[model samples]
Target: MTQEEEKKKQRTRNLVVGGILFALVILFYLITVVKMTGTGA
Candidate 1:
């Protein structure tokens, strides 16, 4: 493959990994909030 194509592929992979990480963080945050409120109430 060409250098430009490799760079593009790397960028796309980075974006996908970043999105998955972001979603996981948000999921964990929501779960924690629910657990906290559930026990507090």
Candidate 2:
């Protein structure tokens, strides 16, 4: 692939990975909060 194409692919990969990580963090944070508060009864 050309240099430009390679750069674009790398950028896309980074964005996807970053998005997944952000989602995971948010999910974990929510889980922690729920655990701390406890379920109803």
Candidate 3:
């Protein structure tokens, strides 16, 4: 593949990975909040 095409592919892959990581972080944060607050002490 051409250099420009290769770079575009790499950028797209990076964005996908970053988005997945961001979603996981948000999911974990929400889970932690629920675990802490859902049940009263």
lDDT of 3 by residue, 1-39 (tens): 999999999999999999999999999998889888976
Per residue, candidate 2 scores C-alpha lDDT tens digits across 1-41 of: 89999999999999999999999999999888888899624
Distance from true position, residue 38, model 2, in Å?
A: 0.3
Report clash pairs, candidate 2.
Answer: none
- Which of the two candidates, 1 or 3, achieves a greater lDDT against the reference? 1
Q: Is candidate 1 or candidate 2 better by lDDT?
A: 1
Per-model lDDT? 0.95, 0.93, 0.93
Which regions of candidate 3 fall more than 4 Å away from where they truly are? 39-41
Q: TM-score-based ranking, best first? A: 2, 3, 1
Query: How do all the candidates rank in terms of lDDT, highest first?
Result: 1, 2, 3
Evaluated at residue 12, the lDDT of candidate 2 is: 100
Error of 1 at 33 (Å): 0.6
Write down the RMSD of candidate 2 (Cα, Å): 1.7
Q: Which of 1 and 2 is the better model by TM-score?
A: 2
